[model samples]
Target: MDFLHSSWLIGLAIFVVVFVLAQSMFFLVKAIQRAKVLKFQTSDIKRVMVSTMIFSIAPSVAILLGLLALSKVLGVIIPWIRLSVLGAVTYELPATINVVEGVFGQSIGQRITDPVLFVTVVWVMTLGVLPPMIIIPLFLKRIQGRVKNIRKKDQRWGEIFMNAMFLGMISAFLGYVIAPRTDAVTGESYVSLLAIFTLLTSAGLMAIIGVIITKFNKEWLKNYAVSFSMLGAMALAILYAMLGVR
Candidate 1:
């Protein structure tokens, strides 16, 4: 929404619409795709979705608590600390927009007058409601079929779970601080459509690990998963942060 760029309200409007669609649309499609590909049952995904949502959301909780905790405690250590650097994803929306326009205004609009809409549209395509709308379900389906029956002896699966959760939390935390945001004159403060893409990009690492867990030995993926996710997420956050969103 061009209206969102000029104001936070409009961005909220776009976010509301996009959020509902993203959470639901991809839930089923991803489930179906993963089930078919993995030869699992579509109906079984109900539990998978529930489980993944629970596991993935944990980091979000941690992020919130971490921010509050960090603010009160760490703020004492580094008196100049600002929320964005140490806060959750939602807090950084304004910074994301401001940095993008201030830093890349010319090149962004060089080819067109409505660079706002141009970026919004492209971002939605690349990062909007598409990835989760297509991935979460697949991931859940994999969890349902391949991971359900593993016993404690399967330390391999345990390591895989730990790795996936670690990466998911890191992404979620950064996403809170640096997610795409837009506001409009209509009084809506919203995250951008690009959030979907960012989520997808971050989730890709988890997806890959999940696949490996299902077909390969966990020890290999485990030893390398955290290091890889850390580097990848850092690069992604910097790239997007510099990209500065509309």
Candidate 2:
């Protein structure tokens, strides 16, 4: 863990955080200035700022949970930096688990104390996300143009195409959630019921929240729905674990 939490790493993490904060502040200031130039009401701007701040809290709670999960093995600094930056929990946890189990053949249940293993995990996680950065800049406009053309030609198929893409991405995670694995010690295969149940629970909660938002006009829940679903599913996971579900 010493390597994971070395002074140099801590300093680098702190530097990254401070740089992100400064970048955010710069953009915020610029936005406010532009808003003023555009003759937006001061009160309206303030209200928007307050509402955004409130809405951010729920998502931050989910990120905090991810940080805790990763911190247990990777230590606090790396996870903190990752989550605080562009990294999403959806991508970070799975990438870490994949590298630990698939690449290194090690259990995430144990801390990554080896500096080489730690570096490898960090590099894999970092590199895995790079394709998106490159792809978006190079091809996103072309993709959007094609989507627009499809929508112009046939709106229904356009929507179906978009939904198909989304579901295809989701299926990748679903595969991970429901996949079976052999216990390293026992050599017996078993699926992770806890993950499957948690996924179902979260999906159920999201569906309920969607119903409330649509049928009952609880629009504000839209901001908090994902957070609530994630937290509820996590709570159910703990209960499942206590009941000996693996």
Candidate 3:
């Protein structure tokens, strides 16, 4: 809570926590892909993971700096845009935080199915502490993976950069458009009850869909899962909003 008042602390904390967590997920995914492609040498897997984790940190550093600079520029040049992004990001915190906490506990899918806990957590998680948690980590992992592995896949850095920008832009666009619509349906007025309900239902469905995909393809949906989350959020919001304005 106190961190909300300190932009510098907020930026730093988001970088450190989300970068580490996202890098770990990247490492885990890479390990799985490696296992699928080659023999499971524990040593090779561990060595690659350790190296990837180290490499992943740099992009996150760049991203955090960019976010901070964005904040500063938007704050000074287009003050309202800063407030809007902050507010939109703030509105999304609860679901993000709960997801992260649950993921850490390996309960992400389980909790997403619980309407009551999910809603309650989303309520608490907002207030501006949690949105950046998930958002930062999601973007960080994607960017770092793209950066480090561009050469692995014979890809170019410019392409990777464009893709990373696309993801961030997509996330923000989805959040802005989808979230408020869900908020309207929520009827909570102050916080939007429908936001959480729609959010969790979508997340739950996504996890199920991901599992279905993974059974055959293994690690296919691991990275793409994040973008689907945005789509899921938007779909639920539209469905709920179709009911009527709150």
Candidate 4:
């Protein structure tokens, strides 16, 4: 565990961070140059950039929450680097849990002390994302072309196909959240009320936000709706724990 936060790990994380920042800056400069060549107004560009930075806050907060949750078991450095880089909480948390609990037969809440187990997790997390990176670049255009062709043939079916895909992805996580877990000590299975309530809280918050956006015409709320729902649901989970709901 000491090595998890060692100076070498910190240094590697810093290098990755710097490289990502430099890459972003390179793209930003190129974008600005292209905008200037296209005769876009400087003020318009500035406003767009400002709005983008402001809109990024909502997702950033969600990432921060993910980092905090993962840090409890994995420590801060790994979660910080993972969340900062090409990983989302949805993927990272599950990947970690699957390795820690499923593969290693260990508790999720306990800190991982075995070096081999830690490396196995790091490799899994790193390699799991590579396929998407490779597949998207190699086949995304072909996939999109097929989707466009399908839409031209029957727009309703195209929409349904896309929605179905999205729902299928979501159902995997939903099942995990609602599934009954057996207590280790008691050898009994029980549904997690906390998970069910948290799920409902987030869904309800999102529903309320959607209604407000549609009825009140608060178009700007779209940017923060997911963040608000996630944060609100997390807060409720904390409150539930404090109130002994579990």
Best by TM-score: 4
Report every candidate's CA lDDT.
Answer: 0.51, 0.88, 0.53, 0.88
Ranking by lDDT: 2, 4, 3, 1
lDDT of 2 at 16: 95
Indicate the worst ten consecutive residues by lDDT in candidate 3.
73-82
Q: Which stretches of candidate 3 lie over 4 Å from their true place?
A: 1-76, 80-191
| 1 or 3, greater by lDDT | 3
Of candidates 2 and 1, the better by TM-score: 2
> Model 3 over residues 1-246: C-alpha lDDT tens digits?
222234774565556556666887898787688696787766656655565555455444544554454333222212222222343433343344455465434333232334444445434434445567688877988877766786566658657767887999968855753454323464543545566666667678778878878787856455445555656666677777787632
Q: Which stretches of candidate 2 lie over 4 Å from their true place?
A: 136-246
TM-score of 1: 0.26
Assess candidate 2 and give its lDDT: 0.88
Per-residue error (Å), model 4, residue 150 = 2.0
Clashes of each: 22, 0, 3, 0
List TM-score per model, in order: 0.26, 0.60, 0.28, 0.62
10 residues in a row with least lDDT, candidate 1: 75-84
- Candidate 4, residue 242: CA error in Å? 3.3
**Model 3 vs. true fold: TM:** 0.28
lDDT of 4 by residue, 85-186 (tens): 788999999999989998999998977788999899888888878888788999999999999999999999999999999999999999999899998899
